[model samples]
Target: MSGITENTKTSGEPSKENPSPNSSDTPDDEKKDDRMFECNICLDTAKDAVVSMCGHLFCWPCLHQWLETRPNRQVCPVCKASISKEKVVPLYGRGSTKQEDPREKVPPRPAGQRTEPEPGSAFPGFGFADNGFHMSFGIGAFPFGFFTSTFNFGEARPTPAARGTQQHMEEQFLSKIFLWMAILFVAWLLLA
Candidate 1:
């Protein structure tokens, strides 16, 4: 990737124009060396590159999207942090996410409002409040196990948002787990 000089006459930073070496429409072995590294997130030829705190470099969009709601995606593709929601360094290569700390930027924690854990969070075999195992299923696929103090297994219902969307499909997958539990429960009842 071309380094953006301290000078700013060109676009006040790096050139915004995409790289287009007019040497050839046909692939040239020599031009390959001139190719700028593309950012993984945006897939654009990078004029500068920024490394994530995880040491991963991606275009602004990819890293930003990853950071925006990273609870859904916990692992860093590069470093594999169990908790990657916290991006340490703002990569400066290409046009990655501008240097900004999520913690500082995160809105004030709501009063008495609990932050929900990711749908299925775990530490290998162990689990956390966000861990997916503490919860179980009913008839249909749905997520009953969330970080909540009030988890009632006696009833079968869906959360308002979990009522639909891809999450519902995941909950349905858990329904099979529920079905097996139901069978086991019935057998235990008869034995008793």
Candidate 2:
């Protein structure tokens, strides 16, 4: 009876000294590994890849379509960080040359945004003078005139207005006006 019990225990449990053939650590096993550079949206190897600020990788087409789908809320699909067409960085790789040209699509991948470095403190000529002020005004004919604006700033650029102030009230009014204009424009497009 004791011998029978011992035999059952040995059969039921695996031996520690000898590992199973199915173990993943075995170097002799040939398994196909999926590439790490897969698109978050399409689940395929990323082509014309772009990396989000949050560091998730995706194919540019997939990300662009996603952004177009929800133009109002442009956020990263993986991390939900605030992202926009201007924010994504395009990846250029040796293999990218072999991929199909991305320009054939309706909306091509967004161009990377580049800004010139700010003038250093030593370069005083480029900066605003102590009492010097700057203002710019442009008057485009008719329809484009609404888009144009005149900006005036003193020695220091004007800061944003605090809530509940007259300046804030004016800003809110202008925002609503623009919002209504945009809605009207869309409605006109649909009718046309």
TM-score of each: 0.30, 0.38
Clashes of 1: 12
Q: RMSD per prediction, one decimal?
A: 17.8, 19.8
For candidate 2, give the lDDT: 0.60
Supply candidate 2's per-residue lDDT for 96: 48
TM-score of 2: 0.38
Candidate 1 has an lDDT of 0.45
- The residue pairs that clash in candidate 2, if any, are none
Compose the digit string of candidate 1's lDDT tens values, residues 72-160.
66665556764343443433323445645333334432245366555442333333333233344343322343223235423323332
Query: Each prediction's Cα lDDT score?
Result: 0.45, 0.60
Runs with alpha carbons beyond 4 Å of true place in candidate 1: 1-37, 46-50, 67-70, 78-85, 92-192
